[model samples]
Target: MHKTLDKLYAGIGEAGTGRSGVGELCALAALSANLYTLVCVAPWLDEEYGSAGELRRRIRKVAAALVCRLERETDDLERVRGVNALFVLSNTAAEYEQKMLDLAEPVLGRYEAGRLTAEAALFEAEVCRMMCNCYCLVQDEALAADARTIISGWTAVSPSGTEGLPVGVALARCEAAAAYADYTGDERFRAVRSAGDYGTEEPETICRMLELHLRCGAVSDAEALCDRIEQDAATGTDRTSQVYRLAAKAACELLRIKDAGFSE
Candidate 1:
């Protein structure tokens, strides 16, 4: 569930709100998603604490407020955060589900109105992610495709050095690479395939890169990464078992890929 929360929060943090601690609201959304998942998967937690319902209310209220906050945003990145958070927080709600495209258009309009700069291109990638998720929530395949087209172009160039990108940009690219693969599969593997190097080296990032390597017929890279993770795990890398588990998963994936004749 935390994994789900982190994935959802990327879009939110990148574009949740412009106010001070806008990132906190992004966290609020992640908390809500994780809690909701917990409650669904383990109903006892919900019955015992009664926190899930309250958390849900808080997420919805804050997300809606952030959405309203976006109205006055003139800055591209801040508006991106607000807009991204809005849909993520309210995506499961039926009333707000239909508003995705309408909500996204003004931002799209802004992009189409002006030429893409290096800065604008960076933000545009994040915006496309928001659109992709919103469209998936609403089952709007057409708009999702439109967003994917934009994503493909940006992702194809694989920010090899990724300098000047925002702090969370690498994580965002990880998500983008996953999403691109989700939408296009083999036909767009190059566009979606993560470089597997550079950016953040946190366990989560490494886990994702391993997944990408196995995903794109780069099993040897995944195997090599698994060797490193095995050492990290043996070193008692952290309080959590994520790294160890990711190592096991990577090793398993390598075998599976090998058996399936997947290689680069």
Candidate 2:
């Protein structure tokens, strides 16, 4: 892990000093994405490697360096990706959450009012997902309300046949609704169910729907989803298949606990 971190840091440092050409910017973006994934899975890495504190320190350093490089970036798409990376990093390093939010606010405002380019729409959806995730983590009423407004705006403008909605937009709405449901103890689970009906077979989306079903005491539905996931895993032949298999196992355990009258 340290060797990988060293390589990532060196790449960022080299890119930071170069002229911000497309190649250099692409390098920085790739580094940022790698760091974001590292932060997201930091807990599991810590468990596996047993250097939690030092690993976290290294992650913080790399994230800070990447953010510094991105601060000088001029491209809107790259800037949005940088912000999203920072948001993911902040989840692992909670102290940076407010700082990330402050950074994102202006960018989000620009995208919100801009003409509806594909990039602009993507930015809004990503920001809405960030806001919803933040609200779920911290239980901030204002953030939740703002996220709700963005989601409502999407719904208001969406065609009656939501099947035509872009997959990214639909997934974002599904996640946002799931987050709201999580915060409110299943109050918005119906919204999650509705948003999740866009014909996506994404594993994360399926897992989220399964979890929400459990939250709302829909044991039969959750079991069916769990069975589907397990069946897919059984026939699959990739890393994702293993991930789905583990998720299914965990879901099964959760179901057992629920049936045993244990608090989740």
Candidate 3:
């Protein structure tokens, strides 16, 4: 882990010099994602390296560089890749949510003008999903409404026969619906459940569903999902082990809530 952190630090330093290309920008963005996840799951690393705020500033610098280079990028594919990287960074850096949306305006405009390629459309869906998640986190009602509008627009004209596009759209819709439910205190998980299939295999997706169920007073349903997760964990694969660990954490939280007399 130290070696990986060393590499991330070195890469960030090199990318921060303002001489990096689009490829370097994308690589730095990936590094930022890894760093963000590590800091989240193992916060002790912050004491070992630097404060969380410092790490975030370093990453935000890389994101800024990525956006600057993307402006001069002439290749459609590279521009999309750079923009996607920017979105990934923005997703982790919640403080930059509005700035990220502002940066995405031109891309959204192009999408609205019906000029995006298949790949760009997928990227647009991701942008919407990330922004929705960010807005929900901060409880930004106004921006969340704007995100809903963008998502609705995308869904109305979403292309067919494009592999993975439907799944992307489904996840985006789930995020939007989840946000609405949270803000209004109206349990909308049932509607979101019927929105589309968010893959059950992914631990993060399952955790999200578990959260929605608990929030909507579906304790039995949440427990059933936890049981399924435990069964998958019994398979003994490393991935399943990780899933099981997450499931255990969720179960513990559920127990805590129940013990505190917060009945579903």
- Rank by TM-score, highest first: 1, 2, 3
Winner by lDDT? 3
Q: Report the candidate with higher lDDT, 1 versus 3.
A: 3
lDDT of 3 by residue, 161-234 (tens): 12244554454355445555565464523254323235566554565555556555667666766666766644
> What's the lDDT for residue 94 in model 1?
45
TM-scores, each model vs. reference: 0.57, 0.53, 0.48
Residue 16 CA displacement from its true place in model 3, Å: 4.1
Residue 56 error, candidate 1, Å: 2.3
Q: Pick the candidate with the highest TM-score.
A: 1
Tens digits of per-residue lDDT for model 2, 37-109: 4434444544432255654554465456546656666665556555555654565566666665666566656
**Alpha-carbon deviation at 192 in model 1, angstroms:** 2.8
Q: What's model 3's overall lDDT? A: 0.54
Once fitted onto the true fold, the runs of candidate 1 whose alpha carbons sit more than 4 angstroms away are 1-21, 47-49, 115-118, 137-142, 155-167, 180-264
What lDDT score goes with residue 242 in model 3? Answer: 41
Q: Given candidate 1, what's the lDDT at residue 254?
A: 37
Candidate models: Cα lDDT each: 0.54, 0.53, 0.54
